[model samples]
Target: MDFNKKVIALLAVALLATGSWSCKKIIDEAPLDKLDITNAYRNVADADAAVIGIYGQFLGLQKTYILQNELRADLVDVTANADPYLKQLANHTTTKDNPYVDPRPYYQVVLNCNDALKNFKLMVDDRRMSVDDYNKHYSDIGALRSWIYLQLGIQYGSIPYITEPVEKVDDIKNLSAYPRISFEELLTRLIDFTEKLPYKEVYAYPAGNPLVVTIDGSSTNKLFICKPFVLGDLYLWNNNYTKAAENYEKIMDVENNNTNINISFNAYKVGYYLSSDYTDQSVRYLRAQDESTLLVDAGWRTIFSAPNTSNVWNIEFLWGIPYNANYKPGNPMIEVCSSLYGKYLIKPSQLAIDNWNAQRQYSGIPYDARGKLSYSTTVAGPVITKLTDNIVPATNFNRAGKWGIYRAALLHLRFSEAANRDGKGKLGWALLNTGIANTFYVGTYVNGAKSPVSFDEINTMQTPYAAPYYFDARSNNDYKSPWYRNTGIRSRAGITALDISLQNNVLGLEGKLIDEGALELAFEGNRWPDLLRIARRQNNPAFLAERVYQKLLKDGDPNASAAREKLMTPANWYLPFDWK
Candidate 1:
């Protein structure tokens, strides 16, 4: 770690931060002296530019995040043409020299965030920045830093939790000062840091705010890291089920009005459902008759390909990083997963294909439409085309693709995971299978007698949960209600509901939730984390190892046994923390 190289990296960040936005003129007009930390944060505009610059540095993480999270999971496998580095990841035999194993890029973002957090506090104390702006920007950066640290711990196992700004490159090499902490300790630190933040809301900029950058006619407001999602995820990993559910419920309750009159615009709800009538493109989808006639409709795929302006797309995606070909950091996923115009480095595993194929649609159809919609069988291999579909024909390049961070399906599935562990297995099962409203309102018979729904259940279903830790899904014959709109994760996928008996078996319900997360979130960079989290929670490393083993066996890999053996040990699950 040369000092000159560190200086060059910081300078590069300054240039990138200044120019990353679509409206480059504002950043370009800033005085060169303002780029320095000493002069930066003197005003609101300067603070905004500094935060935007941090985002520019974050763009470098897109490739590593997906590779580390997906390549090592059960859903994704490397192609024959993939680099040896990628093959090592899939085989769980990563070397120190593997480029993806380098943790400097992750630390770079953390360092930037550390610098910004310190300066923001000073600005607020000096009255240079208002409390409102300080809360919004400070929490945004704090959440971002916590998220990066979490990713580091998840991938590298034990990592040095460095909070102070590293003025010199050599400072990081002194591990004696900042000792590496276990993932459990890291979670405790993050939960404490995130829970105490002044603001927990999304950073929604005003109409004429300079921070609002429009990319290719689509306005980008989802750049900031979601604070509640971060806190929820931290609590989830730490095994605080009730606290996790509470934080997640906060995000889901964003659009809920306190009134009893239920309206339809709940962005947090998984409102998409299958329909034979293809009149409403937003909420309804036509089921494919069979495997051969599986139509890739705009309904499901639009979650990834649709523009940010789309209401349906907005409802699903909570945070996304916009990419443009003309920009410095172009879309990395296109080159990684695309077979048509890109490298075709990796493809979906046979296990993933089988998982999707085994599912029966709501109409009892054999195949899951999401499988075909997510990827396609090509001459080369089964290429994953989820985010890489919108390619520019003129340039033969992917003109745009969003790196999605959080979404409704992932949120709901995670909530269900927490709820099940918190002894709310019935509520968890309903969200995972059918809508909450449908489950409670349509009461089942108990020993020839129709079980009466409780008053609290009925009230919550009809009015919808606003505060505390209750959830509602009953439409009460009014389809416009937000609770009624939630058709559950499986229902949105046009899949049949799981048996009601499984709800009582808490462990079984947890397993089903993980399975549903795979089918829904697959390559969105959540499979590995979801699997790892549950395995750790249950204290069963085999839970994760067996799945990876099965995937390897399905692919006919000779090293499947060895890989499974390695993964059985909790210590071997994380990448080596060898990078200085």
Candidate 2:
């Protein structure tokens, strides 16, 4: 069936159905046409399938979403055989006709979410869904809908806002003529809608319920499309640093919301888990035919590996989406860069490689676990190895890398960024907990006397580093300086300690946090957005241009000057779309 025709039919079903809706026990073949869409709420199974179908639509967005977020950023560059659209995006020269800019896929999801939202009330009234479940789904649908709008707003600047689905032909026609809303307004709406979701508890289908589904081995949680997480993103983009940090903390801190839910953060354990031994001479790092292990960050890699039930609810994945080859197009993200019958559409830029190297240099560290783990060790180049599926060989078309929507590490990185926004006063806490610093302090004024601040006092105040220092210093009669008052920070005894590096200064702190983000989130489709947020926060276009220039220089890009100048234009920062 043609795409538009299918959409029309689906909408018709949403609007016109009057009979009982029934679906097969199997989710993949939910018999949308066989069941009455309007009456789908008549039973628990049907209502569950309806909601699952909305997730299914979101799952289908891997290809476009990855390209839009990753390519335009400095992380990945296009290969020779890459689609022109991909190249256009990589070069920051996207035209109005770039197919990737089309808003249809997002709208399809909106339609699905709207359909579910419109009918879910009937499910609650009819006892097909519990009132609690109804509230849970209410938030779910709202988050998903807001996410689509947010993505559209981010990618294309302004877009027509459609909260309700087009259930009739006239509705479709009317929406087609709807004027575009400003990005600010779209963000406001997105935040408002997502805020309507419950932030207290995570929601999941009952274990035996047919409504339950898995993304890889990890099961689904309606709360995975979480409100706080989405709202944090909206707030982050809106430059509301304090709010963004608060919301993100709700996900990463776990202690707050995961009261009954146990979520742990194993930073070293979060990368791709490759076999301990593999002899692929073309692959870097794994050259030895023996049982040689490549640099592995198992926990970090786990985020992109085939879902493991043991780690499904792990704190590493604050919010994530798993791809099932059986359900949707097997994650196109992994295959797009492989030697195995892949388009090799995107490859990591030399700058991405340099980013890892630079961070290593800054910290005087020899090997960056993330750099070693994320980049291909084999001669296959610097493109990330984070998302490869060990179950699938590189000789095959599908590499089975799970795409993550949000990870706990990413939250930490962004929280650090959010904490550092201009005049936000979150820097002290951000610095303490980003876990990037090794030494900290406790300030004291003995007997409330103006004792001369001594180096020994500062040195003696030092404590071994720990993130989220449970206590903070308050600036008052006891502590006069911001540095003295900073949480978990006494004061550096001296900057001359060869082994004791310091980020006590604001610029140094921001630079370290940004570098940490680059190192940890290299090709995870976040580099550009990270840059954008930082640029806006600092109110400096130079942050955006200089970073792009550095990437261009590292990548040895020829149009560095042209691209740098183009990047200076705020309008060009966003892609052009053929809205008409």
Candidate 3:
């Protein structure tokens, strides 16, 4: 399958790859002495370096990073089963993993950004670099820093916004306050930085920015204003829906959006399933018939014989960045790319299938039991490889080729928190309250003949569904529970398991972070962030209100399940941040 192509692009950096003198100390030598974000600059490959340093913050990513760490729902461990991990994560069973503490990481990224900002200021102030170098790098780093802060503010509520470089030599104590700005203030700052950024041209400006300009005029265009989606997402998160749409639109709109990639869609969707030797004429067909057209990004990537969609911005995704744990590049924006907030449970969720079934019956759409697709050559197509590294002869690209980026949105993330929780929730229907008969039967019967059966011709008269009995539960129960007779669930025919109050801790609350109306970001892995940022990940006493009603001791609610026996409490929210 194309799955091999998924993890191919990410490479670990070597000491030598970090060529700069100062940076070499960081890469080749040892990790920084202080491991602090304070002493850095934006030069000497500094922006890349600082970004990488921030990557350190993500080291403890998979641990108790999320609040209410519940894995029993989808039933997967938080560590493995990558796809399942994501599916369960969306279920609100856990907090967002690997979150950067606000003020700390934001300030860290800000330090890196301020370093670059300072350098850019130096470029403009002293006229050290030429016009081309100045503008290109200026805009490139400008966008980079802007993207960092944008991430900072979005993940953490009200960050201590800092613009200027720190006076590392003088004093860091006289720094900006740790107070946060309003969401509007934060969004505005992001807009300001994003507005000034030059897109699709990561090459530093002037006739010759140092990074891209070779000594002998040869070219080495490492980082540039060229990344496709960086700017698009900036506007997207800012609630500039029109602007966001425009950015994503540019990746496809032919003349307006001159894209360079093949499967001009959010290739990350199905792109993860590509092979290493992805460059082939056959793959071109996949790009030709791209599906990235109708996307939040969209694509017809599987149209031709090509393998799958291309990672073009605006085409598939208006823009997206891979979660570069290093380079501090893996922003929350695409940390899990095609992944969801609900990580896949070691146990898969039947939710998707259930929804599909319900939809099929209601909408008359056909259903495929193999409803979910995974990235395996056996299943994901060119997404994964066979026994060994096998490259088949190139043919026309397969239109069905997918890298797994964009997709249909999720309605609900399955629940997977497997705690032996006993916190019960109580919802009672007393015989006295409804004025029903105080006497309750042993089961779904009135201790007599044919227990109030509600007849349905299909299950009885019709031969196709013929049976001695039909489930006459609901209507039958209506008759039994009524003290007034023939109305309540007293004479029911279906088995009525004992109902009990919901107790124990199983927190369940979810909301959008970047309002879905703004980003239209359907639940992939958003639930974790939602619970974390709002500090709602905790299961406290306040989260649960004890229901103390004087009800008969024996009679209980019938709808209760063992899963609900667990209560929704404050401790269930999440483990403390450093506990992981």
For each candidate in the order shown, give its overall lDDT on alpha carbons.
Answer: 0.75, 0.55, 0.29
Count of backbone clashes, every candidate in sequence: 2, 18, 165
Tens digit per residue, CA lDDT, model 3, 381-437: 112110001112322221011111222111101110111111111101211011012
Query: How well does candidate 1 match the true structure, expressed as C-alpha RMSD?
Result: 6.5
Model 1 spans > 4 angstroms off: 1-36, 172-177, 203-208, 258-264, 273-297, 392-395, 443-468, 476-480
TM-score each candidate: 0.87, 0.74, 0.41
Across 1-580, the per-residue lDDT of candidate 2 in tens digits comes to 5443343334323211211122212222334333336655665445555665666556667678877877777777877768777777777777778888777667767766776777777777878778777876677677778877888887778778876645455455355578888888888878777776653343333453443433334455332465677778899899787788777655544433233312221221121122321101011233332224542434334345535343432434555555433322455665676644455667777777776554322223434445555656445544556655433445453334455677655665566566655343233333333222122333455684323365544443322323332222222435322122221111110001212232334555565566566666777777777777666666777777777776666767776777789988777778775643
State candidate 1's TM-score.
Answer: 0.87
Q: Using TM-score as the measure, which candidate wins?
A: 1
TM-score of 3: 0.41
| Residue-level error in angstroms, candidate 2, position 458 | 16
